[model samples]
Target: MPNERLRGAVSARELTTQRCAELLGVDPKTVERWITRDRVPHRAHRVAAADLLGVDETYLWPSVVDDLRTVSAGRAEMVEFYPSRSAVPLELWRSLIQQARESVDILVFAGLFLPELHDITQLGERARQGCRIRVLLADPNGAAVRRRGDEEGFGVGLAHRVLLSLRYYEPILAIPGVEVRLHDTTLYASIFRVDETMLVNTHVYGSTAAHNPVLHLRRVPGGRVVDHYLTSFDRVWTHAKRTSDINAVIAAFDGR
Candidate 1:
């Protein structure tokens, strides 16, 4: 049977067999065989081709599940772990945002530290440079925010902090390629993803997010950890309300 997944991935990338071969340093006939004859390439070629096509290697070759090395590579996805979110270096945060070429996706309650630590204008600049940015902040007026506030002993302060953070984001909300949404869902983890690399801050009961542990993950082929969080982010984003009128959102919260 032909490897339709490989054929589709290459076609989706608009890459001809000859172009794929050129990039992979293989003959066009070999590339064709991989797709038409369902020939599984060597481990190195598998990784390289997957990276080029922007899909998991296993998706192209299901037989990879039997490869223990591929499973090991998935576990290696966690690049580092910080004892607390505050323990992460400021430079590292800046580097991650600065190096992003494709997308920057953030899901948090307030994430007030972001605009405070780094100039939020950089996000606008990034959007202008063709990078898609999506930010999901908790709805200040929602029950989830109030409940989180009570859990953290912040009362109504968490809502206020989210408002303040929204002010910082207001200017960039109108930027093309940038989207800001408000989600009322209980956020289990705060995700800051810059392209394939992500910083995941896991929330704990009765603890402030700044004190929470953070996992630094870079997406690797067949990695389940990063994809799991990414999927969560997308789910929240789907149900989140897009904020087009910043003043209206604030007014609604204030009126409530």
Candidate 2:
């Protein structure tokens, strides 16, 4: 059963289309359009829905539950922005994954799984070392891969270049001890958990995320942080569609 606390705090009654439109200050036809497009009440309407339900707007969107909880505790979270062209220096990211002994679960958005850029080869080595390594990444697609090519020409056609970017990380995915999944969500961040410690790297460029901040969430075990991350990862993984026909390498571990 869902938490009674959560249910008691939130009203489950579904609002009518007309009622929802009235709350959002939009014409009923506009609401119908949103339904047709599947965009729903969206961010703007979220606020109004919360007011209607007499609950925190976060309640309407299950994802925001963590943010609401985090804020209520007076925890400080930073948001940093950087231009798209300049690379983000995240050395801690490498260290976290490299030293994992028991398990490593990673969630990344716009991460180039390249051996040269990062020690992706090390992931395979760790996998062979009997550590559980799972990576969830955004799928390369129209909007996702659009900027990669225009930023720098990798001497390949648009599609091939995108494929190459994804292929470069195949060694990590092919590792028998690792599970790789491609997710399609705007939640652009990676959580690398090494046992009890968690390092969250937020990779963003341009307007969507300014000064992409990497949040390091730390607390002892049983705080429910790691469990929450695992749940989120699984949600993305189960919904993610698998990528097919990964390139084969002569020296698989070597990433040749």
Candidate 3:
């Protein structure tokens, strides 16, 4: 079940030593020998196992997982680094968002990454279950968007993306336990958190978001990283305009 909890560790098919050996045209004893010796299969067999099991090699060998895990309290618990935003599994995202008990917070431009990917009804159910959802999106017409556009030479392209992102959640503006806001300030990083776990996507100049590194951090006692990120989310949420008032916020920028 622990392996099941990890996205890439489970297979759609049965994966026993006999099954793996059959896939590799080897004896079951060969597979058992590798397991007993605490070793992985050879390169070719490893690939075959991964193929038959429908998992990544890293998923089978946690010690060699490409993702980084930072140690704390000498326990090496509660921090991860996915190679890229897309590399983080959709299941993990859904699991975190659906399991939140206290709060689910998101701060980003257009907010398309999460909103567009998930079912709004499921999110509403989470709210009905007492999880507070706060979403902050960049105001397409705001100064921050303009600066980013000018800096990136994208002009209206970035602004249009923000507008599109906002529309994804417009229908859920009235959903209980869910609140949306539009922020005008410079966005340093995009943050998505569900209760104690937080995923950070830092902005890199001239680079697309999908190409950026992602840091996944779980709350640890006296941990400054998670604390700072949550604090920042709170601060931004305070200054952001409510979804219903976002038009007024934009009008002020347009000198309406």
* Cα displacement (Å) at residue 29, model 3: 70
lDDT digits (tens) for residues 44-137 of candidate 2:
4655555566555444445555554445432432223334212444565567667778787766544453344566778788889999877665
Summed backbone clashes in each candidate are 0, 7, 1
Select the stronger candidate by lDDT from 2 and 3.
3
User: 1-256, model 3: which lDDT tens digit per residue?
Assistant: 2233222332346467676677679898876765655465565665566556655555565554332332342133247788788888889888887788989899887656676678766677788888898888887778887787777778767777776666666666677888988888787788999888889888777765666788888876423467567777888998998766545544554562
- Top-lDDT candidate index: 1
Better of 1 and 2 by TM-score: 1
Local error of candidate 1 at residue 96 (angstroms): 1.2
- Candidate 1, 146-217: lDDT as tens digits: 999999999899999999999999888888999999999998999999999999999999999999999999
- Please give each candidate's TM-score: 0.76, 0.52, 0.65
lDDT of 2 at 140: 52
Specify the poorest-scoring 10-residue window by lDDT in model 2. 77-86
Model 2 ranges with Cα > 4 A deviation: 1-91, 113-117, 142-162, 203-205, 208-210, 247-256
Write down the lDDT that model 3 would get.
0.70
RMSD values for the candidates in order, in angstroms, are: 5.3, 12.3, 16.4
